[model samples]
Target: MPNHLVPIAFELPHITLRGLTNNLTHKPLIVALHGWLDNAASFIPLLTEVTDYHIIALDWAGHGLSDHRPPGTDYQQFDYIDDLHQLLTEQKWENVILMGHSMGGILSSIYAATFPEMVRAVVSIDAMGPITTESSVAENLRTGVLSRHQRRAKRSIASPVPLTQLIDKRQQHTELSGELVELLIKRATRPVIVEAGDGGTQVVWRTDSRLRNASLIRLTEQQAQELMTELSCPMQIIIADDGLLAKRGLWQQREQWFGSAEIVHLTGGHHLHMYNTEQIWAPIAAFLHNIST
Candidate 1:
């Protein structure tokens, strides 16, 4: 419930966006990006475990309270980096720590490599693999369009429930404390729902289609290798044992990007961090501490 936000102009004078930030004793900044379909609340448990580093958690365009996608334009995954770039420009924080989950994780990795001098360290929660698992760009686009279409339909008509009620709904999907759940609920839903169901109403969308579509441009293995080599700061990679990788060694060989890097393995599926924060957050804390000191 300690999350806070203040509206700010990001790219254009007329185009302002909400910048979400988390504070714990006013520590160093760690810009955190949530995974696909998730908001900044995704980092709550991890944030609670850390006593150092102020966490900057963001909602991707069309995801959380951030500005929805520009009229007819679909979500562009690359633009996420651009958004953060504008944020850093406005906030005037360079060579800061960056951490993210899933899509956000991939984004922080890309930015750290792209802006080596501006990033002091980068952490990928579970999104630092080769961009595409497919062979054709057309196929990628096709896949993206279908997924995005579904997401748009869902979010566009999602109904709002009372904050407490919304948290109950989210609990159906995950087992989080009631208080933590409330924090997430308040950040996502509005005060009213025009179409509340008889006993309870459903939020129109649980996921964003634009983000799925934006990932059509995947990096080839060669391209990924090149990006890995481009990283100039400290880096940390955390992979789950139950993740989608066919082989873990692929990531092991890519650590050449940083002057110093560490790898840790967690047990569970892609979302082990959310489901098992107490166990996995330890190494992440150590990694960040070492980098900042």
Candidate 2:
């Protein structure tokens, strides 16, 4: 945990989103969004490197300390944008800059396109835009429904495990440094009574299980491109040479969608922003400088 990062929460009518901020006073607003399964702590390294702006890093609903959607409801991409809009409206903020990583980057791009007036610029790390599916609508729907049902059927209270063991598991899966993984895991777990009448307790992950379910539908490649074309604000996309966007190679074809966006390529893994903090910040700082002037 960065000593400067302060924990804050926004209370919306339906849900409360939790986040960390370096400053809350009047300054250019830079809203940071983390990738799927990652919470606000994902930006701890990057946020520590920049202190001139009022930066708020949010834990998307259900991912971190944020409130989960009402029961029986499913998570959707559009809902996140709506939540973001509501937050900004409640805060009376406008002309903001969005800095996001991976899934966060994807959502930031979509939001910037949808509401260009509210966004002054966008910084996307390891993401270009929405992911399109080649599967037919019916097939996609079927897969989505079946996946939900399977998840619900298989849902069982996870047995309490040693926190270190859990941290180790997450580090292996994410390939992030143990320190980084520990920072995220500590925020995403809670202690629970595992043995009745024995005063024994253990910690379990706090992430909403429903988050693992697949999205019911995805935009087609053409539809995604059309949406990307609507993004008029200045955009900076940082590509990790070894990240998901690079691995997929789809961003190469989509570059034309954004007429003249600044694209920087760095060498690192998917979570490059977290591990390669300084390397990632150089381009971002320059981008901010260019936009501010």
Candidate 3:
């Protein structure tokens, strides 16, 4: 039988998060988080490949079907940690197994470090930890603040386009298969009326465009190292052979921060978890199994 994914929404004090889950009755929750501009749908392929545990894949705030932050407020990297903490507390989930991809992987590492007691294990794909800023401290802060100020007054409604065009555009950039592109388009867009030119209706992305902007603050290399040192839970860092980390010579440094964590190199792109599910699942499953035993 095909796995059934139940749509769920968590109403929090600050924002509402939309997610999809399978087997809520199972213990030791596995939370899957997606990359920037992507949504919970990104995990569908992976979820379908693994059915041993209950898993919930969340659309981060301002992405997918989740609620966006109030106007004039930009998305800060640390805010995601707070949001996840609140969600876990509200749901009374302890000893969580975080499975995060790309940007989500970075957030997962931070969360595991920030609240080591609550996490049982972390499975990070295509990213080791938070990205560090190389710019001078003063310049980094200045640019972040300036960008927010400049973008605050420039908010505008996005123009709608045909669904096929949206999928085609994403395919061009990500090189994702048509099947995966269609799945993302379905979760990330909403139908709307377009009164200009053709005067027909179409779909537009549901994610807050502000998310495309850089964060207001970023962790420095020293801070990231500190965070990595604080991680007590077993971690699994999976690097794709052709992904960004491998290309930039950063994957070689994974052992420095995650000394005890298991590192595996596979053949695929950054989104291997979505595109090459089987290749990625074995290591993650083995890690989870070992921790549980």
On lDDT, the candidate that comes out on top is: 2
lDDT of 2 by residue, 253-293 (tens): 88888768999999998899888999989889899999889
Per-residue alpha-carbon lDDT of model 1 for 1-293, expressed as tens digits? 54443322245332445545544426777887787777776776676666667776777676667777665677666777777787787778977888877787788888887888788887887666446454677876787677767766776554554555667776777545676666566556555444455645334343344555545567677777687677777778888777643145545555554436677888865666666888787888888777667
lDDT of 3 by residue, 1-293 (tens): 13588788999988999988886566558999999889999998888887688899999999888999987677889989999999999988899899999999999999999999989999999999889888887888888887776777797778878877788788998857988988888788898865555534479888887786766577788888988899999999999998889988887875688889999999998888888888899888988999889
- Using TM-score as the measure, the top candidate is 2
- Model 2, residue 268: C-alpha shift (Å): 0.8
Model 3: worst 10 consecutive residues (lDDT sum): 193-202
The deviation in Å at residue 290 for candidate 3 is: 0.9
Instruction: Please give each candidate's TM-score.
Output: 0.76, 0.95, 0.94
lDDT of 2 at 238: 91
lDDT of each: 0.67, 0.88, 0.86
